[model samples]
Target: MKDGQEYLLFLTPEQDGLFGTRGVTFGKVPLNTEELEVSEDQIESSHTHTEKLRTIFNEGRKKYGK
Candidate 1:
C-alpha cells in the first residue's frame, strides 16, 4: 500500500507476516483514482457507491473492534 493512499483491504488473519492461508490472497485498493501511485495484483470488487461502503466499513469496524 502507498503512503496516504486510501486502500480498502480484505485481509485474512496474519500468519508468519503474511495474510490468508495457503494459496489464497486478498485485495487492497483505493477508490479514488486521482493519486494511484501503483497497482495491485488482485483487487476485490465492491458496490460502486462510496458513501454506502463507508457506512458499512465504519459500522463493521466499530462493532468488531478492528
Candidate 2:
C-alpha cells in the first residue's frame, strides 16, 4: 500500500493488551473497491466492534468520571 493510503484492519484482542490481525494471511486489507466488495461480513463485524468499543469507553468514562 502507498504510504499515505488508508486501510481497513480486522483484528482480535491479545492477552498482552494489544490487537493483532484475525488471521496471519488475512491482515491489512486496503480500503479500496475490490477489497471492500469482498469484505461484507468483515465490514459488518467492524461496525459491531466499533459500537462495542464505544460502549466500553463510555462505561469507563462514567466509572472514572473523566
Candidate number with greatest lDDT: 2
lDDT of 2: 0.50
Candidate 2 deviant stretches above 4 angstroms: 33-66
lDDT (Cα, 0-100) at 45 in candidate 1: 43
lDDT of each: 0.44, 0.50
lDDT tens per residue, model 2, 1-66? 447755455589999899987753244454432322233454345767556544543443344432
Give every collision pair in model 1.
Answer: none
Error of 2 at 45 (Å): 28
Displacement of residue 22 (Cα, Å) in model 1 is 10
Model 1: per-residue Cα lDDT over 1-66, one tens digit each? 557655456666676887752222213334444232332443234445444444555554454432
Assess every candidate by TM-score.
0.33, 0.40
